[model samples]
Target: MAAAAPALTRSRRPRLGALERRNLRWGLLFISPWLFGFLALSVFPILYTFFLSFTRYSGIRPPVIIGLTNYERIATDPLFWKSAYNTLFYTALAVPIGVLMAMILAVAMNQKLREVGIYRAILYLPSILPVFAISLIFIYLLNPAYGMVNALLGLAGLPSPNWLGDPTYARISLVLIAQLGAGQWALVFLAGLRGIPIELYESAEIDGAGAWTKFRRITLPLMTPVILYDIIIGLSLGLQVFTSAFILTGGGGGRGGGAGPDNALLTYVYYLYKQAFQFGQMGYAAALSVVLFVVSLVLAGAVFRWARGWVFYEAEDA
Candidate 1:
């Protein structure tokens, strides 16, 4: 057994051949730029932010050590709580709605129609446009008076409530605006839909399974993995939401420069930006960044853990 253990170790750590070593060196050389960028841009910044979280750096002056003061203040800060609430609310509503809309569009796009390609292109056009540009366009569209949306509502004899200006409807409007990007995710779903075996549907048909039954049993189960992917990506983007809100709220400047009316559009990342840039609270912003990083990690971990039960993998069953 002792002799076998040595043999096993040697087998596991077998020396690379000359060609293998040469290939490994070439691969490393090819990837050196990415490695350097990752270390300098990502890893160093993350470590520095963690360090700054414990200090009082205002971007102009040297960072002063302040222990847990910034974190402790976070617990008592009303704006912090409000931003957190707004972010959570937006994410909760937006992610599910976005996922569902993407799935619906994917289903529509997958239909065997003559003009399907044109429809798909039109649906996906919004996703290619710059988010800021889309936000600007939405600003005009969602205007309470004379806006196309409000004009249609008025024609229908419905109240044209202020969308971005009203606190009650501000976040909801953002949620609706988020759907414009659903076409991108729809493409992902369309790929998954295409990957589904036609044989499965044929077999279900032979077994006298209705279209709805086949969809519920086979289509949905097979699509679970794609749905899981969409959910995680949506969650991450929803948490980091800023551009739309910033542009819609006119650079987050209305009513005491609160992100929006009553800070309704004051998302967590926007608050972080205000701290780092607008208010010059770099250390506080660093602490906020750290907290956000931790929260994102936790949420992603939780989603992965929860997905184990529902995210069906065909290979696992096979």
Candidate 2:
């Protein structure tokens, strides 16, 4: 029996080796593109940026060692504070509004209604629109004079503020514009909603649970992981808001740059860009990038930690 076992093992070794070699070849071939791209584009740039953060380098000149000077300067910079405040404020306002809008739309879409496919297409259309196009459209729409938004407000006898021009309304306008792109969030949430087992709903109904009760007890709890995912995405994107702010507020760079009326739309990325490109403070901008990276990491980590108590997983329950 022992002699036969050794013979069987020896016979299987060659077959296993051949199979493993074949799988290894295919796996390496499949992943070569991703590996190449990551090393060239992501890894090299990240390490280079870290090195640059400690040195002062303009595009025209070689980098000079300037240990912590940029960080010290940013420590006292009021513009940095203002931009941070604006970013956090935008995140605070936009995340909740976007998530709520997405959840509502997702719930509505989950209904067994006729022409559901058409409704989904119409609802998801905004998400597929080019961001530049959306920004341009909003700029035209928010034109206080002869704009569709103001024209509608006039018909409704409501006050129409200069959305992109006024300091108070500029930030609000950006938030509202962001909500127009909530179709992506809705789609994500809708997928999550569909993944919930119908049997759970049936069991809840059998227990005499009403719509609100089922949502609170079953739906909300089950959807916590999806909610966490959306919140992280929204917060990360919100903190790095640049394109819409830049295009909408006239893309410019200088000490006194295009930050809208009263610098209301002066986001962190915009400020960083101005520092790096306009003022020749590449080191400072790198420092700002580090700070933004750290803040995002910290916030995401906190969310993950907090989610432990609330984010339900069927595998964990099992």
lDDT per residue as tens, model 1, 1-318: 233322334466787768768989999999999999999999999999999999999898899999999999999988889889999999999999988888888888877888988878888888888999989998999988768999998999999899988886999988988888888889999999999999999999999999889888998899999999988988999899999889998884743436888999999999999889888899999999999999999999999999999878887642
- Give per-residue CA lDDT, model 2, range 251-276, as digits (tens): 86335644878788898898998988
TM-score: which candidate is best? 1
* Candidate 1 Cα outliers beyond 4 Å, as residue runs: 1-14, 252-257, 316-318
TM-score of each: 0.93, 0.89
lDDT of 2 at 57: 86
Candidate no. 1 TM-score? 0.93
* Model 2 alpha-carbon drift over 4 Å, by segment: 1-22, 253-255, 316-318
Worst 10 residues of 1 by lDDT: 1-10
